[model samples]
Target: MSNIESLLPHLGEDDRANFMKAVGSIGAAFAARTTIEADPQVIAALPQVRDHVLSGGGVELDMSAALDALKEEPSISNQLIAAEVKVAEVSKIQSDTANMSRIEKMNYARERGLDRPRDDVASTMTMNEHAAVLAGLSPVQRMNYARRHGLV
Candidate 1:
């Protein structure tokens, strides 16, 4: 028998069942809160723990220790933080681009070398013309434009 299974003999049948159910519930709750990928061993163990609890035969397991064990496992928390940072960066870029005037956007794009000629007439281009040039650039190009102009 496993070390955990050997502990079951200390509890009465009803208490064992309840303990197993509690462990399963705790595992489910932990899975919901974090992005940790599921493991087959963990999947199988939760139900067994519940079964052992239901069997009403095991010693009282330390609930805090069980929870701590889950907490100690490496999770996707870092990946989540990185993803959030990327989203915030994209959001900031979009906000900066939206705030720029058409002329400023065009000049910013030109500074990024987006193939538009740096003609003397560029400074005199109409708002519509500026918008047209800005529209021709990709979203990434627009972000670069904003970054070059210190708008980001």
Candidate 2:
């Protein structure tokens, strides 16, 4: 069994599902946000520094001022920052997924003769069908129909 699957036995069902969702969300976010950079330690790492800037989110900082901050705190770790950013992104994704999953589960339960709402509009009519209905009417009738529906 996978690590997450093994952990499921230890958790309540709701918590297990939540944790799985959180993990999946985090993995997805990390995958999305990752960017590769050249390793600094390797020789022939041209230009002597990784002065690469992130592409436009419209950050407005003077390079000199930014450099001074870096000089003061040279131990800054992108991995930590990225991890925190990813956690927030992942949480949002998990919440959205959970909500959608709940809806889908409810829909499935309904399909299985469970708590389904009545009065569902099951019409599969296309736009062409709707247009045909309009076309079938006399011009005056169509105009009146459109006027009544505020479509005119």
Candidate 3:
């Protein structure tokens, strides 16, 4: 299957694109020059970045060049710096998109009458109704409810 084909089921177009971009960035970084011993932190972050890039099809870069860039930062190693920058950006993008996708999936489930509460045999509410119920609660209350229900 194509990279986005499988991911498409899990993400919307925008999110999928961002995710792919993040993944591509990592791939480029991986392909770029790198020195394993230059910075341990950078070394550690490289794999994570690369994983995102390869999965997302974002960019193709010379891994050796990336490594060299990291090595340039002698203080903490450019690897770590690059890794941090890449990961932070990608992670934020991933999380936001994932949350949106989750909302969509949840809404879809509700639309299909698939999110019926186990305890309420007659409470087959629509997505809107479920959303209403959630909207009525405060953020703290929601957190408490989720915690109580083991959803957190």
Candidate 4:
């Protein structure tokens, strides 16, 4: 079982269900708040519980202290937000590239110097031809293309 699964048995039924729902919304970085040493399952689950509290996961517990605790760690929250932004940017780039037309793909390759002898013919190239051209680019060239399109 995952660490989170193992820790679930320690919570009350309602608390456990709420915690599971809250975990889906919590950022991955919350796990960093935990210590390396083994502890009681309930103690091990505190970071997630704290996240649930901060998120107002329909629990009756007062959140003032949890809010205050989060206020004290602004940097961690900022880092999490920044990481989320990067993930979003990458996802957008992937979706955009995956749906790009042949002309669009060739234009991207040409802009990154991955295409040779750029000409009007590129604009009329078939999808198979575009794929072959893009596939033939060097690793560095491919990386450059991705970076230019904000995939990296």
Per TM-score, the best of the predicted structures is 1
Tens-digit lDDT string for candidate 1 (83-119): 5786897676567679799898777667766435345
Q: Candidate 2: which stretches are off by over 4 Å?
A: 1-6, 35-152
Q: How does each model score on TM-score? A: 0.31, 0.20, 0.21, 0.28
TM-score of 3: 0.21
Ten consecutive residues with minimal summed lDDT in candidate 4?
34-43
Where does candidate 3 have its weakest 10-residue lDDT segment?
A: 35-44
Better of 3 and 4 by TM-score: 4
Deviation of model 4 at 140, angstroms: 12
**lDDT accuracy of residue 96 in candidate 3:** 48
Candidate lDDT (C-alpha), each: 0.57, 0.43, 0.53, 0.52
**Where is model 2 poorest over a 10-residue stretch in terms of lDDT?**
43-52
Q: Which residue runs does candidate 1 get wrong by more than 4 Å? A: 1-16, 35-40, 43-64, 74-152
Q: By TM-score, highest first, what's the ranking?
A: 1, 4, 3, 2
* TM-score: the better of candidates 1 and 3: 1
lDDT of 2 at 33: 44
